[model samples]
Target: MITVRPSGQRGYADHGWLRAKHSFSFADYYDPAEMGWGALRVINEDRVAPGTGFGRHGHRDMEIVTYILSGALEHQDSLGNGGVIRRGEVQRMTAGKGILHSEFNPSADEEVHLLQIWIEPAVHGTPASYEQQALPVDAMRGRWRLVASPDGADGSATIGQDARLSATVLSPGEALGYALAAGRLGYVHVVRGHLALNGIALAAGDGAKIGEETELHFAADDEAEILLFDLPPTH
Candidate 1:
């Protein structure tokens, strides 16, 4: 079964300095029916104005991942981990027990556009951790590049759960296929351009949930960037 969630239907919050859209319930934008898909708790698309960003914030028992779509995001955490995540980079922070962090735009004039994701940890109170990796464009240009995984397979950043996240960049007429594990599920998020999942078309910011399907396919009408989540269904 495949269910679609259009971009326009997502929750929105525009605070002048921070414009965010929630794919699932988050920070005052609650929707009981759209709580989450599998262990994926949050997918927040955020645009931070130049010279501004999120101040010190706390999180616990969540595996947080940040993907920069454009511009750059400067991050500083209690663990003394500090760095600038530019386009083509993925950063993962495990807030086991608890952690305090801050994210801001590094530019004084260019806006910072990025996606913040939260996935439930398989085990609680493990320990706080952080990981960052640069994903070259050529790596995902025509295939699904594993960016995060439970076993850290394919040189992917390790996450705190039994899930795998893959990203792909495709040109017009390009396609990719994935054979689903018997009981695993898949979630596809279109990040750029237009694409067709199975047969239904999806544009940027759109998401699709697939469960119990034996196979999955994606095709792009033009240049497209997509993120795929392979996860064990959550109860």
Candidate 2:
């Protein structure tokens, strides 16, 4: 079964420095029926204004992944990890026990657009760690590129969960397909542009939840970027 969630139906918040759309409840946005999908907890698409960004914050027992869409974000963490994440880069932070981090837009004129994802870890109270990798454009041009997995398979950043995250960029007329194992759950998030999942159309910011579906197809109606997650059954 596939259920669609329209772009405009998501919760929206506009703070002068940050404009974010929450696919699942986060911060002050709350929706009882939209809590999450399987182990996928939060998908926050954020646009941070130039010269401003998120201050130091703490998280625990969560697998946090940051996907950069444009500009750059300077990250500093309590674990002594610091770096600048640019477009095409994926950052994974395992807030096992607890961790403090801050993301800032270092650009003076360009706003940074990114997606912050939070997943429930399969294990808890482990040591915190971080990993960052730049994904090659060719790898995702017309196919799903694994970005995060439990074991870091195919060079993807490792996560503390039994889930896989993949990203793709499709041009008009391009199509892709994926198959899920029995008893697995699937999720599709349209990062930008328009596309059709199976036969239903989805625009930027739209999302879909899948259950009992073994095969999934994506056809691009316009240039589009997307993120897909294969998750274990909810606990």
Candidate 3:
């Protein structure tokens, strides 16, 4: 079965300095029916104005991943990890027992666009950690590029869950396929441009929850970028 979440139907917030779209319940956006999909808890598409960003915040027991789409974001955490994550870079932070972090747009004139994802960790009270890696543009063009996984396979940032995240960029008329094992859950998020998933059309910011299906196909109607998540069933 596949259920589509249209982009216009998602929760939206405009904080003057920040504009955000939430795929699941987060902050002031609450939806009992949209609390989450399996262990995938949150997907926030955010745009921060120049010189503005999220201040230091605390999180625990969640695997937080950040994908920068444009501009640059400066990150500083209590673990003493600091860096600027730019386009083509992925950041993974494990807020196990507890962690403090801050992310801000460093560009003086360019807004930073990004996606922040949260997945429930499999274990609690583990040590907090952070990792960041640059994904090759050529690797993702017309193919699935592993970006996050439990084992850090293919140089993906490690996460504390039985989930795998892959990213792809497709040209018009290009197609891709994926196979989900029995009992697994799949999710597809269209980052930019138009695409069709299993014959269903999706636009930017749209998402799809898939289950009980063995095969999946993606065909681009325009130049597009997408993220696919393979998740374990919720207990």
What residue runs in model 2 are displaced by over 4 Å at the alpha carbon? Answer: none
Give a tens-digit lDDT track for model 1, residues 1-235: 9999999999999999999999999989999989989999899999999999999999999999998999999999999999999987899999999999999897989999999999999999989999998877689999989989998888788998999999999999999898889889888889999989999999999999889896998989999999999998756
lDDT of 2 by residue, 170-222 (tens): 99989999999999999999999999998999999999999999999999999
TM-score of each: 0.98, 0.98, 0.99
Of the candidates shown, which would achieve the greatest lDDT relative to the real structure? 3
Candidate 3 residue-wise lDDT, 97-186, digit = tens: 999999999989999999999999999999999999988767999999999999999999999999999999999999999999999999
Model 1: lDDT to the true structure: 0.92
> Looking at candidate 2, what is the lDDT of residue 162?
93
Q: What alpha-carbon RMSD in Å does predicted model 1 have with respect to the real structure?
A: 0.8
The backbone clash count of each candidate, in order, is 0, 0, 0
Let me know the TM-score candidate 2 reaches against the reference structure.
0.98
Lowest lDDT sum, 10 consecutive residues, model 2, at 134-143
Pick out the ten consecutive residues of candidate 3 with the lowest summed lDDT. Answer: 130-139
Candidate 1 ranges with C-alpha deviation above 4 Å = none
Give every collision pair in model 3: none
